[model samples]
Target: MGKLKSYQKQFQTLLDKGIDNAEIRHKRMVTRPFDFAEKLEKEAKSYSFKSVRQAHNQYAKSLYSSLRTLNERANGYAADLIARIDKEAAAAGAKSGNSKQPAKKTSTRRSTTAKKTASSQSSRGTASTSTASA
Candidate 1:
């Protein structure tokens, strides 16, 4: 938190807001765990333990997906900040005539899991986490 630039400050605020929203949403989603547990218990006994476990896993996945997305958004912002800082440092060095090396191209390659998570979240209509355009 040492002398953050304007954009970095904005990004930090966005990240904090997004994370807080995600946490609140998750809390709302899980406020009645006993209800969910009773609902599952009321289901047909034919539901094997494995099946119930799988169902629980799916529910957990949905519950945690928003948190994961928030983390990824923060990581993306951090990466962008690093790139900006590197670019500014390079410009300063060039101005001082000490280094002639060009800044490395920023690769936009994304993680496969991130793409899948984003697409799945989009399909589920939950991609309004404001990863960009904050």
Candidate 2:
């Protein structure tokens, strides 16, 4: 139990940190190109046409590189989070003596069938009572 709690705390911390880092990275990834574009637009009048085109091309390449980097980092973060969750879940299951195999899932179809039968029986009873009164 204590070990489970420790894992839980560690998972939470990692999740929080991951979220913060992702948010920061996402903001930079989203905003940097726009900021650069704005700067380019501002400086466009001072530079010749060729230089402006070159700058735009460079910006596009950098933006693509950054996007790729961000994607890789996000994937890494997701993998880390999944690993932490699996570790925590395994610890919890072990503590509960369920680590040997997955738990059996109860069938919802049985419950739905039972409910339909119950509703049909109740409706029949009501109909019979109404006929008797009539």
Candidate 3:
């Protein structure tokens, strides 16, 4: 046994209300950052930037857009690869992902023979078991 942990009632109440870990962190991230306009202006000037914070804002938007574009490209590539694989598989005689190859006529005949043999063996087993038990 371990010592019982205690907490503030409000913390417990928040837990009971179904707030999760990421939700708490997301709430924190979404909250306003410190207003560092003066510092930002100085830093931007030191780095030979014009219109303080303008470059940063543009960079953020550009990066975000590029990331979305990359994701779309990736999605398109995946779709293309899947189509190629499907075409290759069809060329190799596989019908669908789930469907197995249709059995050859000769194989179907052999399978039926195997099933009949199994059934006969099972019947023999039952007969022998009954004779021994009797």
Tens digits of per-residue lDDT, candidate 1, 43-99, equal 857689898899899999988998899999999999999999999999999899896
| Worst ten in a row by lDDT for model 2 | 125-134
What's the residue-level lDDT of 80 in candidate 1?
100
For candidate 3, the lDDT comes to 0.72
What total of clashing residue pairs does each candidate reach?
Answer: 0, 0, 0
Task: Give the top-scoring candidate (TM-score).
Answer: 2
For residues 1-134, write the lDDT of model 3, one tens digit per residue.
13333456656877866667768877777664534666666665667545546877999999999999999999999999999998988767654456576767998887777666666766777545433433
- By lDDT, the better pick of 1 and 2 is 2
* Local distance difference test, each candidate: 0.81, 0.84, 0.72
Candidate 3 clashes: the total is 0
Model 1's TM-score against the true structure: 0.33
Candidate 2 C-alpha lDDT tens digits along 7-124: 9999999999999999999998989899999997897778898987998999999999999999999999999999999999999998988747645555666666656666676677
lDDT score, candidate 1: 0.81
Specify the poorest-scoring 10-residue window by lDDT in model 3.
1-10
